[model samples]
Target: MKKLFSFLLLAFMVVNLAHAQQDPQALKILNQMSQKYKSMNAFKATFTQTLENPSAKVKETMQGDILVSGPKYRLAVSGQEIINDGKLMWTYLKDVNEVTITENDAEAESMSPSKIFDMYKKGYKYALAGTEKQGAETVDVIELAPEDRSNPIFKVRLYISQKDKTLKSWQMFRNNGNRYTYSINNFVANPTLASDTFSFNKAKYKGVSVVDLR
Candidate 1:
């Protein structure tokens, strides 16, 4: 479950990257994000995730909130949660009551960056999908391709609201020949969130076993 959510999160990183200076007007607007995004070190947002399979069913709506600081962060969903402290990746499933801790040194986990700028430099293709005004602010719908996003995971797309350059929605393509959809319902940036909230307590689930994958 988390593995898929992580991928969905990674896809967002790709869309949030700064726009190339193809237009002076857009460049100036993109530059302004520098100041606005500083307070974005932390965000608390409710996510509605839908994972699909070919099992004659539809997507499952898993509600959750994510607290992130790039590689050092955590996401709580349903009754389970996943955490990363820049050193470890912990996944705890409340239903099964199992906790799996692993080293954070994974190719996928390393993609964690404070901003989208990191992803563009890592070889991602980006294009603009015109623009629309959300309320009083405008948004640029940008789409990304890894230039080699054929992993059967799915084709990824992103909506970057021009208002804040923040991602608004995302979708994933699964190899099961199914489509998994995910969206951010609301967001609160750099709110007064607690620090320990991102930590995992092994003792909290004494009945569950700890499986270290690293």
Candidate 2:
């Protein structure tokens, strides 16, 4: 479930990298998408994640939601809730009524929700794979491959709406044959957020066990 959260939270947004080798068309679209998110104060969205492993004949789908504001975010999925308020992080398990706390490591932000919008700013090559009809919208398909071959996630594909330049969905291909697809079901740009939205309030979770790993 932690692995799933890593990729699920990354579906939020990404900024562009100035790579000369990147396809011009893809870079243009990426820059536009980045600008769209950079202009927002905060955003909230609901998504559906489908995990599939053909070899194991395993397939599962779940619904999730996320709220992001700068370096803070709150994500809920698969019976778990992860809250990061820039300086710290809390992971709560619903079934066990336990919450683990840890200091937010800045170094890992590139792969975490805080820096998801800049994940593609380095160590990746991207290109526009063309466009296709995704339900009612025509989406531009962009494919990205990590320059470092050893990365667990080998490739990623993003679908952005051609009409509004918003991300519709993304797919992550792992080296271990696990494929995860996240589709944005609903999106709200620049929603007003409460100050405590990103903080973990233990009081709300009655009888929740606290495990401080910081």
Kindly give the number of clashing pairs for every candidate.
3, 1
The best candidate in terms of TM-score: 2
Give Cα-based local distance difference scores for all models: 0.62, 0.83
**Best-fitting candidate, scored by lDDT:** 2
Candidate 2 lDDT tens digits, 1-214: 9877865654422223213378989888888887777888989999999999977899999999999888889999999999999899999999999999999988666566445445666888888878999998999998787777677887788898889888898898887889999899999999988868998888899999999998
Per-candidate TM vs. native?
0.70, 0.87
**Compared with the true structure, what per-residue lDDT tens digits does model 1 show for residues 115-183?**
342343344555554677646556665544554455444345554566566766556555565765657
